[model samples]
Target: MILDVILDALLDTAKLIPFLFLTYLVMEYLEHKTKNKSKQIMQKSGHFGPLIGGVAGAFPQCGFSAAAASLYSGGVISAGTLLAIFLSTSDEMLPIFISESVAAGTILRILGLKVVLGAVSGSAIDVLWRFGGKKRREREEHNHIHREHHEKDIHDLCESEHCHCENGSIIKSAFLHTLQITVFIFLISLVIGFCVELVGSDKIGYFISTKPVVGVFLAALVGLIPNCASSVVITQLYLTGILGAGQMMAGLLVGAGVGILVLCRTNKGVKENLGLIGILYGTGVFWGILIEMLGIVL
Candidate 1:
């Protein structure tokens, strides 16, 4: 059983490695090549910022979440845009589903749902904040000061001999990141497979399938775990029939991988981080229930 689980993980990881490597390689190269242009676009996006962030976040990569966090901290993007990125980010779910031969139609539906949810929710939040007299741009001066210090720190760090960005090794960095994430997925999937074997899929399904509300909430909580492992577990559960589409959607919606973690680290305020978590979990559960009510099956 253990050997079978290991083999399953290896097979799945092998199928995804190439796509993962290529995606990250392209993203890294773009980040390096179009840094100024990207910043200009982000800065001038205005009301369309969240929409852009959502689309970018839906690209099946977790690295965008970290980049979004950085942009938010630098005040180059609004909180709504950052939230949109977090909501739409699926981490390893899309690529994993593709590699597992999930239907392309189903994948499209999932992506479409995430993108719409993210854009609408993010825009609404921004509007509400504006009405509540909490203007995002009002903090520009503070953020500018913060950005200056932040840039200085980066400059000092890059001046050190250990920095690789100055050496034009972004591809190497992307390759290493891909390998790291693949190993993480393999380990998590192996554990999940073993647990399913030991506990039986029916039992696991019963636990998550009992009460719809509880299942949705539990799934959202699982998504809050700050690693790709949560996404792997959710995907595996769904594939094994241990979770329905609604439950899986809830988990994926909240599973921004390390996005929330990065936000907490970069934003310098615990209250803001907590608020983002609440919004993410609430939105995910709401959508989960809505999907269930609509009788949409994956």
Candidate 2:
């Protein structure tokens, strides 16, 4: 059993390498091509970041969310954009639906709902962020100042991701970045997988009992397992007539693949990370309750 779990983790972690490498490669190219005023215009145009992220994230690939987290950590995208991708990402849901032979219309509805919600929610968060506290643009100013005179001791997420960004070859740097994050993800996934196995799947079901109100809340918690298993279980339960559409949506909304795990590992500030998680969980719970109240069938 342990060996099987280990192998599963290894294979799963391996899947992320190509995506990570590709994401880093794109970022490296942009880094080389864009600069100063060009960068500022890009950031300014990020008013639509959530929309872009939403569409991109709605695809079947889980790597998009991971890539978004890395981008947010590096200040390449706004937190709202990160939230949008994380919110829309369905992880294993797409494949499960296709394999289960679910109707194409039904699948599109689900995907469309996630995309719309993710885009709206992400934009809202960005608006709130701009008004509630310091704007991301203002913070970028600090990014330019030399380390010697900085007040905040925050480490650059780009540098923390890897020091290879300055290397001559973009491919080499991207590969190294991919390798580093892959190793980190493998170790983390291994530990998480072992713990999940130790706890047993039966316990997960028990926690999200059949009660509608209770299940809606607990399902979101279950959605946060940081592995593909959470999504598989949630989607299966929904199709089996165990979970309601609202409850399923709730779980799926929180099911951002390993995006949260990557965020926690890479992003600076414990409070900031926790805050993001809180927002994510709250979004899931809020929608779950609202959907249940409205009797909106998907």
Candidate 3:
């Protein structure tokens, strides 16, 4: 049984790769489009630029981190905007939407939630930044860096130093990144599937699926631990009727919410606004309960 569980975990992880790859492609395209727009807008007002920046950042699946990284390195966005987008966006939604047996209504609802959450969270960040009144210092620091970079560029003339490449290069990079990411996701999913089967959702999911209130709380907490594979199992249980939609969404919300917090801490040029995270989590639970109530009404 132990050996079987281990094998299952390995396979599930492998299964996640294809999905991750596909998400990478979509994210890359969104990233390019967003960057171009943000560049134009940031030229006008740096603070207002994050509104669009957060929305754009939310579209990509796996590459939000990479996109966020690149944007930060380029000094294109503020930490608040990056955090808002990270909290609002999720790559896992694509596969879930495409998967057979998953409800179209549920997928659409989740997608809609993504947009709302991204905008709301981003706006909150902007408000906080306004009150903090630290933008002047940040902008001055940014200008100094920009000036230094320009000066250095004039002094150090190296033809080979041009790191920015053509569209073809970006596309190729995105494609390869997607391919590797997809393969990795596929493996993770496959292993997760096997492990859930071995442990039986009834044994695990059952305990957590009770007490709507506590269930929702635990679902989010459990999602905090590493392992994307477990999400597959948790989501499957929900779809299969072993768990309720509310429970499933609760798990997803926690996973995405806490996941963003964790990433924000580890990542540079990113800091999450706690108020925004709370709203996202609260909204998730609200939606989850709404779905449950709908079942009774229908």
Candidate 4:
């Protein structure tokens, strides 16, 4: 039974391998297009850009975390946008759409819900940030502005000897590197799926669903762990009918919102964007409730 579960999980991950590769390519292209644009512009024009990013991201089956990394590295999108992608997209949805777990109708409903929620959350963050900036500007105008010591240009400093490169070469390198990383991620996801089966996702899921408050806390905690491993457990919970759609969605949404936790840990500049992290968490919970309520009502 364990062997069969392992093999099935492996196959599922294999199916996502190509998707991960493609996501990297598309994200690279998006980075290319937005390269010269100001961060302020992305921050101000939050709705369309994030909505597009989320919807396009949701269509793919995997590697959003990798795409988030690429976006952060390229500086095309902010941490909030990355969280939006995570909140809304899922690989398990594709399989569930085809299997007995969730219908195509359910998948569509979920995707539509994701798009709306992602856009709204992103817009909310941007609006708050803009308001904060406006207040800061007002204060600076009224009071003497404090100046920090000038630092050397960041571009003059380099992380790697090969960090600087022509656009074409950089894009090609990012593509190849993303593909390689995704292949390994696929293997890891397969292994996680096998373990979930061995432990009995159904039993574990029931325990999670029985307590709403605990379930909410657990969802947030599970989200703190990086990678696709949590999805395996969550998906099983959904499939076995152990988890209500509300609880399962809450966990998954929370997982997506904090993806920048991984990005912030890895990148310094991204750490400055930690303010967006709270927005992601708040929005995740908000929509989680929304999803849960909707599931009950409809």
Q: Which candidate is the best by lDDT?
A: 2
TM-score of 2: 0.89
Provide backbone clash counts, one per model: 0, 0, 28, 1
Q: lDDT per prediction?
A: 0.71, 0.82, 0.50, 0.55
lDDT by residue for model 1 (216-277), tens: 88888778766666787788888877778889899888888666754665455577678778
- For model 4, the superposed segments whose C-alpha errors exceed 4 Å read 1-46, 133-168, 175-207, 257-262, 270-278, 290-298
> After TM-score superposition, what is the CA distance of residue 82 in candidate 2 from its true location, in Å?
0.7
Extract clashing residue pairs from model 2: none
Candidate 4 to truth, TM = 0.68
Candidate 1 similarity to native, TM-score: 0.65
Q: For candidate 4, write residues 1-298 as lDDT tens digits.
A: 7666566655645554554446445544444455445455655665566676577557545456545644554455654466567667664545654665566677777667766776666656656765876787778768978645332121211232143423355456455554455455545555655666566656666657776656755654554344455665676676676666666666666555223433453345544545555565566666656556666521
* Candidate scoring better on TM-score of 3 and 4: 4
What is the lDDT for 177 in model 3? 51
Stretches of model 1 off by over 4 angstroms after superposition? 1-43, 135-207
- Residue 185 deviation, candidate 3, in Å? 12
lDDT of 3 at 270: 28
Whole-model lDDT, candidate 3?
A: 0.50
Of the two candidates 3 and 4, the one with more favorable lDDT, higher being better, is: 4
Query: Between the candidate structures 1 and 3, which one is better when assessed by TM-score?
Result: 1
Candidate 2 residue-wise lDDT, 170-207, digit = tens: 78777877787888888888888898888876778667
lDDT of 4 at 192: 53
